[model samples]
Target: MRSPRRGNAFEQAEAAFKAATKKNEPMPKAPVTPPAGKEMVSLRLDRDVLAHFQDDGPGWQARINAALRAAAGLDPA
Candidate 1:
């Protein structure tokens, strides 16, 4: 059965082209050398914990990272 019309012609054509050209590509291998700087990660913190860092407006993330580093007994680099 034909699919119901949704988006405008250009959008529909683009969607069809993407589906037709898609492939089951293998995942890329990890790099041999570790990344030089800090890596992105997701962490869940309590509301109060987040608010405490965000109170200063700017540099909240850096402050949180520093707090974590201090708690881990690492020097603030």
Candidate 2:
């Protein structure tokens, strides 16, 4: 068997570099679709319109969705 390294600055540095370097991590899985069938989206809204929906706080997203559905003449989600 090989003996342990001792007082070897170059060997120590190489080991340190290897330790500090990033290791291969598993690739992240794609985001799953929600059972509710709602897809993630980005929508821009006027500040006042956003504030109006947000004033009640919590479920503001639901309120916005309901309002949009209503405006689109679709049933409330």
Candidate that scores best on TM-score? 2
Segments in model 2 whose C-alpha atoms lie over 4 Å from true places: 1-35
Across 6-37, the per-residue lDDT of candidate 1 in tens digits comes to: 99999999999999989978899987763578
Give the Å shift of residue 67 in candidate 1: 0.5
Q: Model 1: how large is the Cα RMSD against the reference?
A: 9.8
Per-candidate TM vs. native? 0.51, 0.52
- lDDT per residue for candidate 2 within 1-77, as digits (tens), equals 99986759998888899999958898999997765868788999999999999999899999998888898989944
Q: Compute the lDDT of residue 49 as modeled in candidate 2.
A: 95
For model 2, the local distance difference test gives 0.88
Clashing pairs in 1: none
Q: Candidate 1: lDDT over CA atoms?
A: 0.90
> Roughly what TM-score does model 1 have, to 2 decimal places?
0.51
Candidate 2 colliding pairs:
none
Residue 18 of model 1, lDDT score? 98
